[model samples]
Target: MTRDANRPLRICMISYRSNPHCGGQGVYVRNLARALTDLGHHVEVVAGPPDPLLDSAAKLTMLDCLDLYNAENPFRTPTVRELKNPINLLEWLSISTMGYPEPETFGYRAYSHLKNRVHEFDIIHDNQSLSYGLWALSRLVPTVATIHHPITRDRQIAVRSVRSFWKKVKHLRWYSFIGMQKRVVRRLPKFITVSEFSKTDIHAEFDVPAERFHVVPNGINTELFYPLPHIEREPNRLIVTNSADQPLKGLYYLLQAVHAISKQREIRLTVIGTPKEGGGIEKLVKKLDLGHIIDFTGRVSNEEFREHYAKASIAVVPSVYEGFGLPVGEAMASGIPVISTTGGALPEVAGDAAMMVPPENPEALAEAICELLDNPEKAKELGEAGYKRVQEQFTWKNAAEQTVAAYREAIRDHRKI
Candidate 1:
């Protein structure tokens, strides 16, 4: 199977669910696949949809599933005809019982798809679908997985966020897939993650050997996030990308900060995401009576992102934890002065270009926001600095080169085994 080092490597990048608009997973898949292809590698993305929206250079293979979590009709019971396939039946039954089964089911689907064609690629790069089927795939090909961060942290935070016993039980049941991830990841020979913090934490939680992990920071998509000079920056206007109800995103604290600041001055906060109807965040905004000052821009397109940044005086990331903090990098790339909390790997992404606050502290977020608003010169300077940092250090080209090194290492190790 040895090939010339100068030749392009055939890479199959797999993801169970990939929607670029949803979360970091889709974003990661899209950017990484494009970058790798740009590096003269033959790249293909094997994904379960809502489309990944990949660049035309990279090939895309759509893997179908029941898609029970589709937003239009979430958790809908699948038709009996759809469940005729054993895999589809397993997926429906698992979700019906309050268990998340996408990762495991997708792994099975991927294995079934690729088992007969193992020689089509030099390596299989899994985007955290750490499932039993992945282990089986590893035996057939050189497989490496990227564990963005341990979902164990998610489970811990979710369990702690709820008060009722049954509610907590439901959360535990939903996150039961994490147990499968833990079992599968440890068996893989090589792993990739975004930050040292993530690598350390995942090793501690998943008990994977530290040497097995490779740390590669995510790249900013500058094409979508660069500053718009033609657009005027509005004063006392702030923006944040919100996962409104998730305790992990810390939008609740940001709402409080906005409420406190509004008492003394004219301030407006534009959230680049929608809150769930009558969700905790929506309720919090109503309770604080901050609707006048806060505007949630539901479902922003990629083209509209920079304009939102251009109009904002400052951007804030109030995350309780992050594996890499893509929003911080996006803000930095957009040349917006940023105030970010010292959450997991946020400081790593932000470096010294942002104002750092203690996570989950509304008062600190308020103070930092106010500081930037009161001093336009300082805010502008920080924005320029952040833009410079991203340009010099966070290009997808750099990430792609590092990732190829890890891929080669995995290939060599696989051959030896």
Candidate 2:
């Protein structure tokens, strides 16, 4: 069959610093773009430095920016050549002053590139890069942003988690970009969030009305997370994919629970991530004396992720609050029983298939882990149920279709205005 050039809608997805390793935002972008293309739409991603990986069918336009926070050499001072450009200087100055400038700078860079080719795209989809540049683009084109969750939630968690005034101040500085995001969210005609919890949080935190928001839960990449049943599961092992460096992830609580569980029974924990050297989590593991039984695999490839799931008896997501718990969906898809807290959108994603406990409760977590460990039959039932639920409800194809609906709605709303 011959391809029809005019059949597919041209899309421009803007993301300001998508690090695939750091979090789900990058995963969301990569998987969503590929799924959208699979639906016959032409997606062209305009991403900032450290670009997102996309499907071969989708084109990626790497928008150059000062990648000061590049994980390899985070907080590195800009070179003399980098300072010659005003935008680069602005980015460097902001970072030097303990501020985040990527969203604003990336938005400016996107606008600079898109202004000349604005007509080429059917609509612009901003991936939470709330900057003045994106606001400018909204004026000229139909624009909608996907704010996964309000950043204010993260900041609130961080501030409350720490006692040190200086550390709180540092947390505030790193997340100072919320100012830009909130301002931009207030002005944008339409934006989407991944869950009802996030929609309510964004409205309360940013004072954006519920009317401007759309709820589209993220999808799990089933292909990467499905079961490898040939690999034997460990009988007394627990696995959790944690944001090891952040308190909001509740890794400390999980660690405490694991310590308690280990004392009663010889159980091991496999953490599918590495904690930063000298970070709070690393210190806590030592403090709790959990080094021997706990294993932090740092970052792992997709094959490794599935392999880890295959070897684990159960999966846990101990986040205090999640915009949407990708780990829960991924674990479910991997045919692993999940034990998650009733935090944020975890319940929304986990539904009734997995065991639930309260957030920030080590006692509740240990009870759940122990109960499942003691009953192999119950664990297997939960695992099969979780896998069935994910197969029926969550997949990238579904997310892309729902997202496209929002995009078209945004376009229609823009023309009406």
Best by TM-score: 1
Q: What lDDT is obtained when candidate 2 is compared to the true structure?
A: 0.88
Q: Which stretches of candidate 1 lie over 4 Å from their true place?
A: 1-3
Measured with C-alpha atoms, the lDDT of residue 345 in candidate 2 is: 87
Clashing pairs in 1: none
How does model 1 score by TM-score? 0.97
RMSD of 2: 2.4
Cα lDDT tens digits for candidate 1, 1-417: 556655789999999988898588899999999999989999988998788999849999998889887888888878889899999999989898889999999999999999998899999999999988889999989988998999998888878888999989999999999988988887899999999999999999999989998899999999888998999999999999875687888998899999999998999999998899989998998999988888888888777877899999999999999999999999999999999999899999999999999998999999999988888899989999999999998988898999998999999889998
Model 2 per-residue lDDT tens digits across residues 1-417: 324323577899999878776588898889989999999999999998686877558899897776777778877877899899888998888888888788888888889999988899888999888899999989999998999888888899999999999989998998998888888888899888899988888889899989988898899888788999899998888899884678778888999999999889999999987898999998988999989998899789989988999999989889999999999999999999999998898898999889999999999999999999989899999899999999888888988888888888788788898
Lowest lDDT 10-residue stretch of candidate 2? 1-10
Identify the candidate with maximal lDDT.
Answer: 1
